[model samples]
Target: MSELVAAEDVLLFVNAAVTATGQREFRSSAEEQRFSLGFLHEYVRVNYRPVYAAALALDVNHHNAALIVEGLLRTAGEAGGAEEKRAEGRLIAARLAMLPPQRVYRLFRALRAAGVNNRRTRAIVRGWLAARPDPALDAVKYRTGVKAAVRHVHGRPADPETGDFLFAPGRRVRYGNALLDAYRRAHYEQSAVYELPFTVAEGFAAKHGVPRAVFLERIAPRMTRLERLRTERASGAGAELAVMPLTRLALYVLALPFGERVGRRAELTGALRASARRAAGPYAGSWGRVTAVLDDSFSSSGSAVKRRRPLAVALGCHFLLEALAAPGAYTALWTSGGDDPLMVRPYGPTPLGTRILDALETEPERLVIVSDGWDNAPPGLAGEVLRVWRSRLDPGRGTSVVHLNPVYDADGFDVRRLAASVPTAGMRDAEDLAALVEIAQFAEGRTGFTELRAYLDRRVEHFLTEAGA
Candidate 1:
């Protein structure tokens, strides 16, 4: 519906038809590819081609005047419509043909070596080289080198080693593997998680037994770390010591070829689907009042009773750094970082969050729930605990909560009404470190850790005796 896509919609359709027509004809490979390029230029417009072309042409630098053509092409042996696939082959050739002879020779040689050498493909490369005023051999070389690096040497220059073809074994495997490594370095996983927070949340849920919402809340504190270095650089953070995103780490690890690695995606996916099922329906979030109502109906003593404690779960940012910083402390129940099969809900809440909560409620006396709101747990577990406590606890039951910043209460809470008023001095006196130290000593003497510890000890004894401990 947006202007950009809407404007190009019909063009893509027309281009597809032309591409089909070009494939059916038996013109030389070069001519077929040129026809395809012309059709595509008309279809997507010359402007769009240069977006990618300009990227290539910048060092061959003529900003707007550079006439470049671009389009996708099938590599040597990929499955596709015969005509369509043939046209794609020609398209690559046309793009290449526009380059200078040396560049054309190099590109053509590389492609041929990779086994993509149809006449149309060679001509396409030649034509593109022709349109450019300057020959960008370095650019061509660099691109080729990258292709070679991935073993997609489909168009890469030959290596001096065994004289064996590099990427010829598997084009998809070669290109895909290269793309995976490149994308990983560029840190693309962050974008993937942002695009699929719910999915990631589910992963956490199943792995950690935490509900999605609670997991999100626990991860809230760390969200600021997600600030992009690119944005910071623009704002003058400087190029040095720039922080790349954690999402990239997550994405790279997730995208690894699973066939060779984890091989257990189907099972993980089923667990995620099952977790999703339980949290569905109208009573989905009603666990709050459900606990309170159960508590009230079951016990009149308002004291020690066998009951389940609410689950508290936290989910942190991309787990890489955190895992590295404190590996043994964490119970990594599962990891999808390497060649493991891709989990359908790889980005979801830690499933253990809920499991932990279930355990807490089943044995309230055995565990004490303590967590920093900023720490990560599986999703939705924290909120579950809060809900249960608020609804079911005795009026006298109290909890000490910490708020990181005052901004948390800014949303029309009328904080002043609930807080005790404190007076500000009309005049300020500068108190150096020594004065502050003296004041602290006075305050400590009056009421400090010593008194507080005694009070806590007395309370602990009372509570223990009442419970027959």
Candidate 2:
């Protein structure tokens, strides 16, 4: 056989090992072991060398190496490689099964640190103890370790059973919190990439029993959403849901009566007002004046006035939840945002409006007011108001307004394409606002789908370049 093994070949071998189907024994001969290790080292260099190095440093055995590799993959590349993690757990179980009782304790310590405390995993550990039946001492030893770890102030439980440690009843562990803290640190710093994937996998797998490949194929997208939600929740974004000031324009228009067709007008107007009422509770007493505008429009007789209500009603629902949940956290309705055509709110005004006026006056040069050219206002009305609002923003405070246009919503009305045809500077439509918000986010250091595409583009180019090189 040729001495040189390609990176792809080494990857195939490693992949097989992870799935528990490869040659269990390393090459018996010294020369073959050398070639194998060399191939393994190169494979990791291109893929996960950093993780392998860390795990290998702790224990140079094949089992630990496999765990660390998959862990790093899940963390760095997969985000939630549940299937791979489950496979790794099984390998750990198998290794523990072969070891003596004392050796099994060490395995438990490592596995626990990785976040694998499931019953199936625990059973494997128990099997080792069964061989040496220390019934009287086993519970005591396990309980003591658990209590000490939990009481250490640093310990946080990896599992949901908070305040209770993994090994014993009443002996709580705080390892979970510590692990999360460590995860944040390592992920931000990129120093401990391997451990997190391993840790997260073990933690999730212990609870969910997801196989590694299935995790990649199935759970990753769902996990990404949950992860994003968790991030927003931790940041206090969820509780802060409130209406945007700009959206009040739509609410004002919705309350008015329009066209001669009086059939669904009353029903539509009622639905719009109810949504507004439900939203009013969040801002204390801020809802009173906004709702009055809607009620007065019904008493008016002008057809021109009534013509604006449909757009107003449609835009009113969009404005309330999103403006309150501004800068992000926008969804149509909690249930609807999760489904169909997939609605997501674009980013909104920068530095926030509550602080915008004061901040602009104090530190004028630092202020940036970003808006999408579109809001759900009638074209002429939306344009005039935005300009008037911009004037009030205090140019003397050194504030600069960036009015982004060509807003889009895969689901919204097309103000952007219309704007391209007309390029009018006046009031923008709902489509304009949607596109502007998306663009503003992209402009303001937040990565969007386009940014991700750009990243993938660069990576692809680099790969092709390296292959040619």
For residue 46, model 1's alpha carbon misses the true position, in angstroms, by 32
What does candidate 2's lDDT look like per residue over 1-469, in tens digits? 1212232232223222221111111112334333444454455544543333322222123443444433443343332366644543444444444334444454455555666544444554444444434332333234344433343323344344332324443444223444333433543443323234332443444344555444343323323333323333233332111222233334333333444114444444444345444553444232211110110112111124233322343355344423333243333321111221111122221222222223324432212222222333233443443344445544242333332221111122211211211121111233233322323332222234345344334533454344345
List candidate 2 segments past 4 Å from native.
1-77, 80-267, 284-314, 317-469
The sequence of per-residue lDDT tens digits that candidate 1 reaches over residues 330-351 is 2222211112123212232223
Candidate 1's error at 397, in angstroms? 47
RMSD, every candidate, angstroms: 28.6, 23.4
Q: Pick the candidate with the highest TM-score.
A: 2
Once fitted onto the true fold, the runs of candidate 1 whose alpha carbons sit more than 4 angstroms away are: 1-86, 89-110, 132-134, 137-469
Query: For every model in order, what is the number of clashing pairs?
Result: 76, 23
